[model samples]
Target: MPESVSAVLGPRYRAVAVPVDGGDLHVGVWEPEDAAATGAATPTAVLTHGITASHVSWAALARALPGVRLVAPDLRGRGRSRDLPAPYGMPRHADDVAAALDHLGVRDAVAVGHSMGAFVALVLADRHPHLVRSLHLVDGGMPLLPPPGVAPQDVAAAVLGPAADRLRMTFPSRTAYREFWSDHPALGPYRDEVVTAYVDYDLVGEEPELSPATRPAALEEDIRDLVDGASVQASLQGVPARPVTWYVAPRGLMDEVPPLYPDAARERWTRELPTLRLVAVDDVNHYTVVLGAHGVRQLLPHLEADLR
Candidate 1:
């Protein structure tokens, strides 16, 4: 029996199954009763969540922004779209956005991406230039390239952050998984109500074996790809000459220091691309930049000043 998604999103949001590439993509769209009142027709923003997170992370922000439509996909192998084929990278991720735009018939869009979603937004500019008119990169700066003089062992820890307890990461029960999230340092600040539905739709179980949609291979591949960078970074060789806005948080994964390459790369790219712009938000860590209400506040004014 297929899981009941309606049980997760309540009745306010419509769950649309978008078929693209090699699978069906699920998009949660918020369309109020009165279109004009909420600025639905005029303001449309397709959002992308960061790694390890789903559309639920963007729900508060999407709800707060007036006069805007919101479309949040679970990304390949995540949330409701867990069945998407593998080999996921930024380009294929960008293709997912393209598929969503084509399905929604959005000719030109104002795209907002957070973290991994930010990378997807940038790729949308590079790959599907005609599909997007403006871009808002949240916390995901330039493609983080491997730095010089960094050792292999240190590289993984430095770039991807504390080694994922990958081998030790699977869970056998939704209750346990929910508890894991409750104690997660990153998702802790978020209100329980907002993420409760998310926890339901995203976690999976298989009797004595349960786990998230996240595949260890995909995670490892993503890490390897970031380390390799020959593909995604090369794809960013020349960004579009349209409205491009980037937001960077003040803090990082730990109390140590934020990865400097991404910031440096964003600054460097800013100098090169005429339309490329940058905004650095103070007082928030890298994860908070898109996880909590405070992070959304940090992005609103910049998005308004630029997009509006």
Candidate 2:
């Protein structure tokens, strides 16, 4: 592998494949460089990335919380595990994460999720309550109320737009893929090695024809669940009144003024889910919420709020 996105952050990591029903799930484990040097066990945080994202996306978080061990898995169909057979959905994703935790001998962990990962995290906590101690949702997990009379597929089309459309397209080279993202409104602000590492890892195949590793069919199912899935709904309703914090960026994927959750929608959700603790971080869009420096700086304090 090329230089890791988290290399300069003083974290030591190794990737392991944990066997599941369908296939082996690739899990990357990161530990504080200091702790690894001294050979001490640390508390662990199991991270789940957004749709079409791989474990590489958590490099920022691994750097930010070096004191805690990080366990991130490339959800089936998005990374090294892309070949894993489908039946993809939020619950299936949750089951895979739970299996990863168990395989690693981690009896309990703080589940961290970003975007669609938030929904997966919630279901993980619900399905395997004993394995998850607390839930941290970044810019997602809450049920998004689709516009009145809009079908689920139409809602996904409107919300995802280019993010989903790019799945069907192919790029000529990895550099071309990077160049493609360079023009992205949300990604433009973050033109760094970390971002490059992420986008480069996303592409696969020959120079003449390379495509993003994410499968459109799998992403479609996951997005559908985000909009209207029974498992997510049940998890939202079943989770106890615990102090779960959702760190939201104030902008959308395109760096739009109003974030994914507008003022009124945010207020309504807050009232509906009284147990959630919502914090709007400034100067970040949906993609930056977990990938950028400003967002990670805001996330660290919350991640280590109550170390057990």
Candidate 3:
């Protein structure tokens, strides 16, 4: 781990490699301050990251929830778990999350997912209902309606342009990688120690040929599952009956108009899953919806309500 990340996570953060099917999954655990001081059972939340993101992506949220234990995992094919073998999809990712929770003796956790993690969280709640108490989805989880003329298989490439494209590219150094993300419209504006630590932790290998830790194959498989997979479709069927709250970002991935879940999409999902509460977070884009302060502010109320 980078020094910046250590500083950002502070002294209470620890990394645990939980054994899974193919290999071990890297899980970042942040112990709650209040719970530790009073010897109370700390509240736990399982935070799943996006398609191309790692556990570090949840640093801000972890900091915001001082009394809640945050368990974030680098799902197979991303971050320190990048080398974990294939057969990756929503089910596999959800199982990995369950394994991490089991290893830590955590149950009935508030499952919070951002982006691709939202899809995983839904599947987790559906498959391992005993493991999750409630669901908090940020900018994802609801079915993504691809634009007209785009096939289901091509939605990953069409929607995730630069995010998926960077997997194949290599940077000369970590500084170069930082410079690359500094230009991202959504992330550039909020670039700080937390974001920089995330960027730095993303790079793996020696200098002059460093590359992103996320595997293209993983992103491809996960997106396809999210779009039209049988498992994801089945998971959606139970949303109306489950305790779920989804937060929508007004901006897109690049901080552009027409966010990932527009008003029409939200309306359609709301009608279908009438029980699913939808909150529109202002000013943040897809990435910022979880990485920025605005998104965290919107999430605090829901977390307090659900965990209380």
Best-performing candidate as measured by lDDT: 3
Model 3 quality (TM-score): 0.97
List model 3 lDDT by residue over 212-292, tens digit each: 999998887788876777888999987866689999999988898888887888999999888999888878889887777
lDDT of 2 by residue, 143-190 (tens): 776656777668777777788888888998777888899999889768
TM-score of 1: 0.82
Model 3 residue 211 distance off true place after TM-score fit, in angstroms: 0.2
Model 1: how far residue 290 lies from native, Å: 1.4
Please report the candidate that would top TM-score against the real structure.
Answer: 3
C-alpha lDDT values of all predictions = 0.66, 0.82, 0.88
- The full ranking of all candidates by lDDT, starting with the best, is 3, 2, 1
Q: RMSD per prediction, one decimal? A: 3.7, 2.1, 1.2
Question: By TM-score, how accurate is candidate 2?
Answer: 0.94
Which scores greater on lDDT, model 1 or model 3? 3
